[model samples]
Target chain A: MAQKTYAGVTVELTDEGYLVDKNQWNKEMAVEIAQENDITLTAKHFAVIEFLRDKVEKGETLTIRAIGKSGIVDIKGFYELFPGAPLKVATKISGLSKPVSCV
Target chain B: MTEKEEYPLKKVCIICAKGNLEDVYAACVMANGAVMEGIETKVFFTFFGLDAITKKQMNHLHTATVGNPAMRMPNGWAFPSVLGMLPGVEAGVSSIMKKQMEALDIPTIPEFLEMITAGGGELYACKLATDMFKLKKEDLSDEVKDIITVGEFYGLCGGQGTQIIFT
Candidate 1:
């Protein structure tokens, strides 16, 4: 599959889902990917991505839908579009050691 | 651990029936879950279920009386349906139910409606049921996106990869 770049994130779309180079992925990149895929980017989406990225930075593993449910995009859509990608909520990934609350 | 792959369901339709406190709470929880899961969600309220969506009556939604197996009273006591006919009985039941739900961290029907809408779920009023009950649009919650017939609702549901769920 040909690799695509969105906001410096190297992404490749596959039958399973989009694969990204974690080194090149960031919250801005995720938002850009959603936009490219025609998914509406709301404040909630960004919040989740930010949370997920923080977990990764902290060496914590997480899932995307575990993030808060306020986003406009369906959790199903998020998983389908970003398979294997961790979701964050307010700087804390679900499986991460450190817990950060956005409330 | 690796993240589990999630296959997204396209849509969900909720059918709400009027009952006691538990029934109302169940409807709200299901609807909220659908919206959270990213399915396009719609809720259809009929009969007593309509009270949960009514502007003024929503906060005062009550428990059903008589022949309902789900109802329970203190000390294994059961109330008769005849008592339900008395004025303020419904209100009393509703208030108690509300208090219980609040303790359980469940939001009220109006709050649930707001959560669903804020999460991008659609809200509709049943046309035939509304007309049958002499309910006007003004009587419904302000969040209602539209008043639609069952056929129209089905039309919206008619697409590739959509699922209709009755709660």
Candidate 2:
């Protein structure tokens, strides 16, 4: 697993996808991740992250395509390859009935 | 060195008239540099200059072909007014110029206005010119601080440290 530390959060790229520590997901974390990944985090990216985090909280398996279209990832093709495993889209990973745009 | 010795000119006001893309971009680049230099800046848009500030028309600003001295076309060729009349030609030229400027990190006029305002500069519309052109406040971008008469502009330009420049 290749890993990087961003703003004290451990982000590891696994065979499954990106694994972000639950204790370290926030606006600062998002900015750090974007910066580390060389992606420009625009206002639209923030909107999508909030939306995806809500979905993760509700226990829905977020489609990689959906995540890409949501505007968070500047490179969608890489994310599109991982469609199976319950990808950890949010830091506070929990099981729920559905996905909400935010907490 | 003391603050006074480190920096001198306090304010600069620029007047822009409608012209070719190079001229318009040159005007914007000058204003941006002045703002970066910590000088208070004002850009007053009048007549065809309004195209550089209006939202819908801003992206299509072009360089003057007939009498402009700084214009150069592809392969050392000069662009003729007849070719400029073709549909989308002006926009193509504008886009090319914008790409070149972006490569050089010079902000577009709208972006330049945002930079200026963020840096404590002011942007205004020429009231008389606006009325004569039948343009309303809504015709301009939301960043414009206000519309003022030429006399009012002069009032803002007053003081020994202020320099007014026409582009």
Candidate 3:
């Protein structure tokens, strides 16, 4: 039961720093989280985020290889964008839950 | 709140020492889950676990039907050991498992490794194990980041709050 404040908004977070309530997420929060992770948000990053959100909304599993095959970015490109643990970092900034299929 | 309050774990190192389909997937699943939780994750494959990373055996991994007390049939009953001894039973069981995984949309072994690696997880092959098995770097799947010694593997886990998982 921890909280993170961003751009005048505060939200609850899990111990892992994931937003506790998806509804509490906003674009600014995404930006803030990305900055905290040493990532600068770009259209390409947003594209991956949007793809993640869309997939989550539709109840589809997300996998790195799936993203690699999606043509938005290849596996190597994903690493370049997120830099570290791409799926975890991307999902965090996307304001989405951690993907269960990541493993 | 403190940083530790926000993120309890710093890292996780998962070791895959067995090669059977069940054991290898168990390690893969756990390693992937750790990274999904935002934990820095590294997986070290050693011994028979090399089979999982080896190009020729990765996709064709077979389930260990013999002496597997936890295995169950389609009816939720204990799998018959006698049936396991019959010809083609191993392949039959392995195919069934593959089919079930496919039905669930789970990726194959190589794809799974690709997904894990692309997600920022690290994959390493054991130097001793590779040598023992006579596997060259070219024989492994592309997902393997490097062949590292056991000492080097431990060095990667040298971080505060890092957990080591062996399967």
Better of 2 and 3 by lDDT: 3
Where does candidate 3 stray beyond 4 Å? A1-38, A83-85, A97-102, B1-7
Could you report the DockQ of all the candidates, in the order they appear?
0.07, 0.02, 0.38
Chain A TM-scores for all candidates read 0.45, 0.49, 0.92
lDDT accuracy of residue B1 in candidate 2: 62
By lDDT: ranked, best first: 3, 1, 2
Please give the lDDT score at residue A80 for candidate 3. 86
Better of 2 and 3 by TM-score: 3
Model 3 lDDT on a 0 to 1 scale: 0.85
What is the Cα-based TM-score of model 2? Answer: 0.56
Alpha-carbon deviation at B160 in model 2, angstroms = 1.6
Sort candidate 2 into its docking category: incorrect
Every candidate's lDDT? 0.62, 0.61, 0.85
lDDT of 2 at B161: 82
Question: Per TM-score, what order, best first?
Answer: 3, 1, 2
lDDT of 2 by residue, B1-167 (tens): 65655547888899987645665676676675565455678888887887777888776677655454445587767667777777887677777877886665455677666655654567888998889878788988887889899899888997768888888
Shift of residue A11 alpha carbon in model 3, Å: 8.2
